[model samples]
Target: MRMDEQFILRVPPSVAERINRLLSENASSSEDKSLDLEFSEDGRTGTFVIGNDRFPASVLDLPCVVESYKTYDDSALVKTADVGQMILVRESGEASPDVVEYRHGLTPPLRDARKRRFRREPDLNPELVQRDAGDENARNANKKAPPAAAAKPEVPDTGGNAGEPDGSDSDDSDDSM
Candidate 1:
């Protein structure tokens, strides 16, 4: 890799995801969208319509995978940054808006962040754990029958009869009275 040779930062898988997230957060503003983004070869050039702005394919960055025609590498499909959409950049000075390579790759800052995220998972925060446990308890509470309520047996009334009534006992026996 030389200063003049085409070189990009090699990134880990976890770092790549974080970079994408940060980029989304950065681009969330309306003002950010108004700022022109310029990139090259993203399938978006001539492929998308954005209001009155008709951006050509030259303005998008394409996401790329390093697919070597030579099938002899350890990881045959080299992981590479493929620009996806043309980014419209704000004009510098009086110059025209230029397209540049902006990629969704892992940079140092995001790499560290991703590492921290994965590494810190085992150091559980008691508060967060409690909150999650509380939520789970609430969700399951409806399914559990409480012991106090369950202990009371339902007594079925057989109209005061002791399972059977002797037929010799007549109801009209009170007629003599």
Candidate 2:
């Protein structure tokens, strides 16, 4: 599709309802009402955010333009189009109306990075894996025996006014009052 041309995206009824609700809520709350739609790096999944609420959504058929944008950079805001009204696809005999729109968002670089960083991968680091295995074996070997109690060090006694409750020197002979 041309850059200026608008495209349509099909979302579930729940998503459409959420969009409508967000639109209404934002319209009453602020003059700059906007529906922020962000998609995954793969463009397969997305989410709609308005104010503090977030609604997760999936794209049935992501357009090439969005995919192109995602490929261009780590962070991409593909396009901004006027969100059209929900319409029922009578030809397809679909029970729910689809949300028509041309705008979409991409997962931010930081978000994607964080996701990758936190994702579990046992074989990611062989050294770490080996260390963990060793630790497990050590724990299992020592399971039968209780750990020895550590002895507390005793403080040496110093005969002086160090333990005075006033915590001040008795030689307070100040001549310069």
Candidate 3:
């Protein structure tokens, strides 16, 4: 990581002294240790390197009280007992191989929306129930219908009684057959 991108951590003086003592002891050990420790110029931040794995200074300073370590397909998740935060480190060559931090594990804080529960009704023209008497179609209809035809008497049905069914029950039966 670039020097500008590195995070400058703030630690207590006693904790810093203890970390410095531990680093010196680890450095003078005859056995080849897997972890390589490095401190920042201000003596506040420390880096712990193990093989290809790298952790933040704040994360490395925590005591060895790990809650869990879950290995995924392309990443590893670490949960520490000191802080209730889940740290996710992705494998190399991945598109976004970065250390991600989560408060709980999965969910994040709620965000604001540009719009919410918005409704819109389409524009519509009113129904034309009444037509103007001076319209061309109205004038043409009045001209097409003569006054004599409009004054003609109404025709009635030939049933035996008004508003009743016909009494005839004639069925289709051929006498020649």
Candidate 4:
């Protein structure tokens, strides 16, 4: 449904009966017998108020109410005269109850992108990106050095005097001891 369009919400029979009962009960005591339907910020939940008493209400199959209250700048007001049986919600003036079925969730409403606020593009630094790339290149070069060192031929060790740092005669060293 359009943001500015008027829609009708068919009140359940149980709720309508209770409202009528409340209206009749408060007719003698209370001066204001008007039905007030106030929706939560999310529009999924609502309350029906008459005089001093309040009744909790759940909004069923009305995604447009949820979308309008959450996204658009338009505000919804229910006519007190239309409070009996069904509710007529309009931006400004009165509307017929015949337009109720079209506003249901059968056909998804088109959202106006122009009315919605989108996130701005993020700011990036060219210097930081270049520095990160350079650091990665250095790390890759260091990683290559270890493999190259491992590829070198290991020298085979010779037993006895060949393994020793200094060459000496064994019999001569024993005589000195």
Candidate 5:
């Protein structure tokens, strides 16, 4: 719950270290602990204890978290900024008493996005959902399968020149001999 404690953001160890370094470098003389990380879910936020106490907490506004995020991005954890991967930045609630106090022992679902597949239910109308059966056949039919290429005649090897015209019967052969 302090500015110095902001370095405790749950991140990869390597990233965390880098973040800590950055935070220390950017540290101000006076510490501020007004910001915190708060997590929440409509009906699915709970804690599991191995052998420690759990308590609700708020989100932290920390430089380490931001720096850690940068490190992860630089490391290409999600792949890329566009196309192959994406990073989802979201705010659960405004900073204040209205913030959801998630349990400490609980593993909050960070960057929880809906499943990509089946994002929207199929249309109710059968006709609208109907797929063209003959479409594939028609497409195949329309595409004229290219004609098989004519086989090239193999040139006879006379030992003179493979592609040169055969003039064995000419005076040239007699001259060579």
Candidate 6:
């Protein structure tokens, strides 16, 4: 955070505002949000707290040693964030980098991997076909004979009294042999 040295940074106004709000809770006197940040020669950084605790931030810059043309993807931070207004320091690093909201969201666009999907054949199972054939033969053999009618389900009789007439214990007291 010195005057000359460059550094990486990620302090957009929105983020700074949030930090300012967090630091303003117990300001003894006023609700002020002014800040003065400074860094030491030994890389020790400090900030002057004014009305609140929030202060501006900037990151060290990263060196672009290995460079290449990204024919596939755009610059990593083209439109991911509203970072155009964020502070930048001489320390080499991108400021207010936009991180992906969800790691699995929006998979990088893919090429036509399977252009011949229409030409693909339907999946077949020889074992299933054999089982179907067996079922068909069984049905044909059973076609010669008719199935018997099913018996009706028995219903329990409930009389007005507690002891009801059960088939196992008949109430035919009048038919004494």
**Which of candidates 3 and 5 reaches a greater lDDT?**
3
Candidate 5 — which residues are off by over 4 angstroms?
1-106, 115-129, 160-177
The reply for model 3, stretches above 4 Å from the true place, is 1-32, 36-48, 52-82, 95-177
Preferred candidate (lDDT higher): 2 or 5: 2
lDDT of 2 at 144: 73
Any residue pairs clashing in model 3, and if so which? none
Q: Provide TM-scores for the models.
A: 0.16, 0.26, 0.18, 0.25, 0.23, 0.21
lDDT of 1 by residue, 38-124 (tens): 444644332222223433333423333232232456567543443333333221222332545443323444333434543444888
lDDT of 2 at 168: 46
Better of 1 and 2 by TM-score: 2
Which ranges of candidate 6 are over 4 A from the true structure? 1-9, 12-15, 18-30, 48-50, 54-59, 65-177
lDDT of 3 by residue, 19-118 (tens): 4665667645623235555766854344545434554453322211224443566576754223333222222332332223321222222121112222
lDDT of each: 0.43, 0.50, 0.40, 0.51, 0.37, 0.42
lDDT at residue 99 of model 6 (Cα atoms): 29
Worst 10 residues of 6 by lDDT: 99-108
Candidate 5: residue 43 Cα off by (Å): 16
As for lDDT, the candidate ahead, 1 or 3, is 1
1-177 in candidate 5: lDDT tens per residue? 533222333433443444456456544431331223334673223221111222233343221122223345565544222211111122233223343322222123422222322255555766544545457667888998899999999987667676776567767578755
Model 4: what TM-score? Answer: 0.25
lDDT of 5: 0.37
Error of 3 at 16 (Å): 27
- RMSD (Å) of each candidate, 1 decimal: 21.3, 17.7, 20.5, 19.3, 14.8, 21.9
Summing lDDT over every window of 10 consecutive residues in candidate 5, give the lowest-scoring window: 79-88
Instruction: Return model 6's CA RMSD, one decimal.
Output: 21.9
Worst 10 residues of 1 by lDDT: 46-55
